[model samples]
Target chain A: MNDQEIIEQIKKGDESAIDFLYKKNYRMMVKLILKNSGTEDEAKDIYQDALVVLWQKARNPEFVLSSKISTYLYSVCLNLWRKELERKGRHTSSEGMDYGENMPYDEKERIHIVQKCINELGDACKQILIYYYYDKLSMAEIAEKMGFANADTAKTKKYKCKQELDKKIKTQYTPSDFLD
Target chain B: MELQEKIDQYLLDQLSPADKTKFEQLIAGDSHLKSEVALQQSVVTALGNTRSMQLKARMQKIPVSMASTGNALRLKWIGIATTGAVAAGLIIFFLTGTGQEKNTESAESSSIQQTTSTEISPAVVPTIESTTPSAESQTEKAEQAVVVKKQKNTGTVAPSNEIKAFDNSANFDDIENGNVTTPNAENSSAPANTLYTETNNKLSNLSVTVDNSNSKDKSYQFTGSKLTLFGDFNNKPYELLELNNKGQKNLFLSYNNEYYELVWGQMKKTPLKKVSHKETLEKLKVINP
Candidate 1:
């Protein structure tokens, strides 16, 4: 079944939907966890936690998945695993946390402010920024995926969105605010 | 170009080397410019983290299930639910605990089998001698013996021990029951037959018996590069050994569910099927003989 259909079945509390989801992703999830310093049992546990989170989100009527179900699940699992690693004080270098260690308080606050600004930039700009900065997609690729006329159009839009984000960030708080 | 655009390019490393050097100089000269670059870098890092979190969450939404028998399938679901609850609690505890406590807790949890020898048989007693042959290791040997005694009393059985040893000179019945005496056994005047028993524990425990009578070479060595398909673990077939074609003596020992590929007594993790102790010993005999 398709992702939407699976979501509908889950919303209807169909057990088979849950089974279907588990059977489809178990191997990949297990491999991902195993390669990331997790044992077999730990992989199983993380998979289940991710499923539970998906179930809860599916059950909510207001919850909308803008991305594919697999994409959403992957993100959730990655977040959970990173949090897990952080909690355990295990090395996170493998997960691209080179700058995470010994981050200054002001730098952290600045990032937090920037994140808030990005969040307020509306879904379109947020997605574009994520696609450009996070996903590392080329402007042409982002334009094609996001349904823009051309790469140049996407570039201009991204610049404007970034400017708006920067403006919001600067207006939200001063450096002195972080000192307090 | 606007300073903001230049800063973005600088953060992304899109600037030419000369431009980057100039930007660095500018930042070094101006505290305001330095702070701006740092803030922009932080922004990029934050966005990267946000994207990572999103991607991880999406990947996790995929379904997972284990292969199981008819009645066992039902139990598997029940086990999943139960374990999920337990895992949730553990995650909370891990998050709340201090860093040192978390490390201690994780260490204790992983070594639970070592501390609690309730069900599994002591399968490594024979292999331990070949692996660590120092006078200072008497305490570890005694501990292993105690574990074996406890396993013997519990009446746990291993499928691996059922296979007879390959030594034509030794009685099949005696070897099958792990009643063969080693040189150490003879020297110490003690019976040194290594017995194996299977347990439901996922931890791998394997022991190999070296036939030292032929060479008087107290140390056993394995020389093979091709791993042979020997047996299965939970129905998953795995190639257990890569035999050295040159006929070099090598020690093949499996302990605690880990295959130690010892090349000249230096241990390295080898990718091999988790097999019964009997299978490993039999394979060792085949390679050596």
Candidate 2:
């Protein structure tokens, strides 16, 4: 069933809708999350977290969906992946990140350069770039999740963080850093 | 479009094909625009790949039990409720005094006080009914009725010694039928309404135990000396008996059929009443006996 039908069933406390939702989107959600630099385990965690948020919010009487189920799921997974990066970055430096560019590049080179640059970037940079570019989250949503003052502040921070990431990559590599 | 905004949107794959062609034209001739695009493109690609890998790893680790979120939440609440109940039990055990001497002495004096106090106020006595079931069903129905009979002129006065005596009788009946499970089960066997002042030292040794396999690690206690004040006096006496369990003094209050652990020296001016002891006893009797 579609999200609306599933949501209606869920509102009635029908158990099957939850199962169907999980089964239907679990793999695609995982794949989307994996594209954001997470492993299968991280993908599962993000998927579950997204599912949890959806399940909890779906119970609210006023929740309305203005997008497709896949879009919503992708957004949630993307947000969760950013959070995971932020958490990991707290204890370590973002040194060699695996993501390469916004345009779909040669998947292999894209994966290698992205991972290497991501490894060099700081937690803050990793989170902002992943949210805006990979997850495609709005600046406002990113700000709210990260506890920033507002969307403008988050956007400013994102710009600074990206510059920082680019600088770090240039210092580490002699070639005109492919990842600006 | 503004230069930075245009470059930012172009790098993010958010720009339209027309804008993309414009960006390509600029990149072909402009060093700064080409450099900006190069940096942002590399960063975005890196982010996407890392996310994809992380998602793949997370998906592989999904637990078999992930579908049982509702059950998990229910179990969490059940654990909390059980912990609250056991903590309440320990509180009641401590407040009522525990050792043999104190238990016996408190049981004896409280019974006598209840009898004399009731005789003094004959008009207030309600019809006495024995609802306690037979020995086979003693644990199932150990109702200790403590009716503090009073005339219209007097307010809801304290229960008499007769009621305490009646509770003691019921307690004995519970012990005889193995209704209680504790080292201090002998004392708990007495009706819940038996009121003994803190003077009895043995009451300190009593403890209530709740053993559930799913229960948590922490245990709680209520000091008996400060709380057992429902005797042959007015309601004001409870205010005096109310002692706060500040800093782990271990005093708990039983009122309205719930146990509250006193914290931060905030003691109630009045004793909290509980759902009638008879009702709980009846429930216990049904479940156990």
Per-candidate Cα lDDT values, in order, are 0.45, 0.43
For model 1 chain A, the run of ten residues with the poorest summed lDDT: A91-100
**Interface RMSD for all numbered candidates:** 21.9, 29.8
Model 2 ranges with Cα > 4 A deviation: A1-111, A174-180, B1-4, B30-32, B57-61, B65-289
Off by over 4 Å in 1: A1-101, A175-180, B66-289
Write one digit per residue (lDDT tens) for candidate 1, span B1-289. Answer: 9898898778766789999999899989887777666666766777766654554455445432322212343244335434543565577678888423333212222222121111221122111011100111222222221121101111122322122111122232332222333232222211111111121122122323223243321223322322222222211111123322122323343322244344532233233333346754544333221
lDDT of 2 by residue, B1-289 (tens): 5676777788656677997887798799977667666766666666765555544444344332322223443344345434544565567677876622323221322323211111121012211122111111111111111111011101222322222121211232222222322222222122212112222232223332222232332223234422222222221111111221111122333322233333323233333334345643333222111
True contacts kept of each: 0.14, 0.16
Chain A TM-scores, per candidate, are 0.49, 0.48
Q: Evaluate chain B of model 2: give its TM-score.
A: 0.22
TM-score of each: 0.38, 0.33
What C-alpha root-mean-square deviation, in Å, does candidate 1 show against the real structure?
A: 24.0
